[model samples]
Target: MGLLDGRTAIITGAASGNGAAIARLLAAEGASVALLDIDGGGAANQAAAISDDTGAPVFGARCDVTHAADVEAAVFQTLETFGRIDVLVNNAGILLDTPLPGLDMTAWERTLAVNLTGPLRFIDTVAPAMIAQGEGGAIINITSIGGSLGFASYAAYCASKAGLMGVTRAAALALAPHRIRVNAVAPGIIHTEMTRGLYADPAALAEITAKIPLGYVGEAVEVAKTVLYLACDLSSYVTGTELTVDAGYVAQ
Candidate 1:
């Protein structure tokens, strides 16, 4: 039996990258999943692919986590189909590179909306459903090492993620009484479409890789596995924690 068998999950920003990877892994472990993304078509297609691969019940729909109506609709659909919501993965995020000399104000605002507040919007929606279930659940937010490491030219992204850390802690305490657990996954230098551009220049990629004690870039699956631990009983006693999957980058 898999760790998450008979459970249900809602994963945001699941059309591609880390979100998609996490969805696939959880479904493979026997959890039903609702994949939500701004790219509705892509999310639907990915749900089809994961369902085919795992034979797990999966749904996909358009959801802009920044919008309350979208989050509510998606959760309603997931509950209607799956009967209960057991895990919520807040993985939908955006990173716009606006340098200090002439930082784009629009980018700053948009980044906060998507990366920071978006997760909060989801938590406020999903937490109620989870509490109603009476069995409690898990909420995992995808933070970044940048939230602590402070990458140049990505101040808004960093600040938003750091803000999420605060959200995770506060939510964890508030939800603990109900057996619902809240946690954050902080990833470092993962090579995905969202982060591929950061490594496009060979010299820059090389420099970043050298800093990693592992001497290699990370993968989406690696982060997914960390998420799995938090999503299932393996982490039954864990909550209000920021687990770093950063190849020891923060250690230095």
Candidate 2:
């Protein structure tokens, strides 16, 4: 049997990249996955692909994590379809590389809304149901190494992720009694659609790869595997922790 047999998961921003990889991996491990993305069509397509590949129950919907109503509706839809939610992966985020002087307040606000508040909404909407089920659950937040490390021109992004790390810890403490474990997976320089710009420039890619003690860029599946570990019973005793999947980038 798979590690996540009989479990159900909701993964945000799952249309592509790390989110998609997470969804696919969870489904392979026997979890019913609900893919939520701003791009509903893309999410649906991905869900269909994973379901076809793994023969697992997977579906997709349009969900804007910044909006409470959207998040609530999507959670409801997942519950109705999968019957119960055992895992929640808050993986939706945007990167805004802006320095201090030209920093856009609007961009900063949007980043917090999507990166920080978004996870709050999902946790708020799902926590109660998870409690009612009485089996305990796992909530995995997709934070970033940027959350703990300084990055030039990434003021808002760094701040938002750091805030999410705080949220993960607080929620973990608050929900431990109910047996719900909250944790975060902070990724380093992973080459995804979100970081396509850096990969597009050979110099930038080389510069980033050089910083990693692993001596290479990380992949979406590598991060997804970490999410899998947290989502499964393997990390049952783990909570309120931030697991960094940065190829030892921040160790230096």
Segments of candidate 2 deviating more than 4 angstroms: none
lDDT of 2 by residue, 30-102 (tens): 9999999999999999999998999999999999999989999999999999899999999999998778788
Alpha-carbon local distance difference test for all models: 0.94, 0.96
TM-score list, all predictions: 0.98, 0.99
Q: Please give me the total number of clashing residue pairs in predicted model 2.
A: 0
What clash pairs does model 2 have? none
Q: How far out, in Å, is residue 6 in model 2?
A: 0.3
Whose TM-score is greatest here?
Answer: 2
Query: RMSD of each candidate?
Result: 1.0, 0.7
Evaluated with lDDT, which candidate comes out highest? 2
TM-score for candidate 1, please give it. 0.98
lDDT of 2: 0.96
